[model samples]
Target: MEKPKILVTGATGSTGAPSVEMLLQRGHPVRALVHKEDVRSTRLKNLGAEIIVGDMQNMDDVRAAWKGVKRGYFCYPLNPDLLDVTVIFAQAAKEAGAEFIVNMSQKQVAATAKSPATIRHFLSEEVFRWSGIPTTHLRPTFFSEWFLYIAHQIKAGKLQMPFPEDARHAPVAGEDLARTIASILAEPGPHINRAYQLFGPELLSYAEIGEVFSQTLNKDIIYEQNSVQSMADSMGLGGSDHFKDHLANVISDDLFGTPDMNDVIEKITGKGPMTLAEFIDKNRTAFTT
Candidate 1:
């Protein structure tokens, strides 16, 4: 059987780029929608994916990218335009007669949440579901890549926390989530209209995560509980007031987040996801400052 050509949005980002590569590696045709024809797109083009340069918020560009694509993966970044983008993308997918599309969502997203962004996320999920498209929603936990946000702090041998001492979570890697997205696109039959909660292999608090860093990097590490604003500023997540509101609510949401492990990646991709230590070691330079 000929595999359907797949479309991946945000193709230059953390998850979407990798999803494109893995889909191509799995012997499926891939179309990558990037914002520009830059070095990253060039690399993906070198890897044999048809590259389309366009903005996801533009209806015509999305329509053009979806042309002849049967399956798709949609991921937007941390901005205020998610709902608007979702509306455009969903309509484009419907017009394209898409067979299946996977959406990237964060865990603990609820309509009742205080974050407008969280509400937007919930609405975005419904946009696809209401579009009558065969869609799968993946609600993943925090990404281990978030550590890079505070690389300076980590390089100084400290893991900063913005939550209560009791709060814990299993930080997932975006690459692992991308693999799961590829698995679903590679075979979309079983996942139609399904929502999966994705996480890592183990749960740990900020202190424990610091311990892992100390062990893996062989340095004396410490964790300091910080105020949300301080933490957000330190990680550069406090640039805008609207985004800070979302960040604040998300921090509140994480305080009560489910702390457990799941095998979603292993089940879908036939391989377990990497731990924080292993991820740090692999991207050691990023953490080394």
Candidate 2:
């Protein structure tokens, strides 16, 4: 039997990079679709992955990249216009006859639409399903690596959030997300037409996160509750008041409220997902000044 050729879109991003690595390690011929011919693609090329340079928004570019690819792992970078890009790519994938598409989706699809990320992911899943391709939607919860966005604040010894200090989230590790993607691609028959909600081993609050950081870095850390405006300003996220208001609404309602899906991870990958403490410990260097 011949190894399947899997084309991974967004191959330079966190999840895509690891997914590519996992596929190659499992002896699959992997092709990485990157936007620009840059150092990221160079790195993947060094890792023995065939690199195709193109942007998802360009249909001609996407079609060229999809040529002869049997499977796909798709992820959109953080963007408000993701829906438009996804629709284009989904159509291209269908026309190219890709057998399976594993999407990197958000947990927000389960609830209100604050950002277009969740809605776009849902739409892409629908596109794959309607196209008659076997699809696996990997809806992972809040990522523990999101703390990297605010790592400087932790290094400054302050943790500020829009929600309460005790805002709970089931933050999954990105590597676990990659592992699940690899599992689905490696053995597509089992996950055909199914969506797997992936989560970490436990639910943790911001307060608990702070505690973990403090213990890991051996420094005093404090979690402060900031108003939506203040939080947005602190994060330097410039937008209309409506965006801020929607963010506040989602945060208040706790969009991270989801049950543990570690069982699914174990069932699919035959391994337990990484824990929050392990994630913090592994990435503790980012929190140090």
Can you give the lDDT of residue 198 in candidate 1?
Answer: 89
| TM-score for all models, in order of appearance | 0.95, 0.91
Q: lDDT per residue, candidate 2, 1-289, as tens digits?
A: 8898999998988788889999999999999999888888898899999999887889898888888987999898656667777777777888888888888876656444555455555676676667777788887777777777788888999888777777777778888888989989999998888877778887777788778777777889878887777766666765555446646656533365645445788778889888877886788788774
Q: For candidate 1, write residues 1-289 as lDDT tens digits.
A: 8878999998988898899999999999999999999999999999999999898889999999999988899999877899999999999999999889999987877777777777788899999989999999998877888887888888988777676555678888889999999999998888999988889887887778888889988898887888778877887776676667776787666524664667878988999999888888988898885
**Which candidate number maximizes lDDT?**
1
lDDT of 1: 0.86
Worst lDDT 10-window in candidate 1: 251-260
Each prediction's RMSD to truth = 1.5, 2.2
TM-score for predicted model 1 compared with the true structure:
0.95
Which segments of candidate 2 are over 4 A away from where they belong? Answer: 111-114, 234-236, 240-246, 251-254
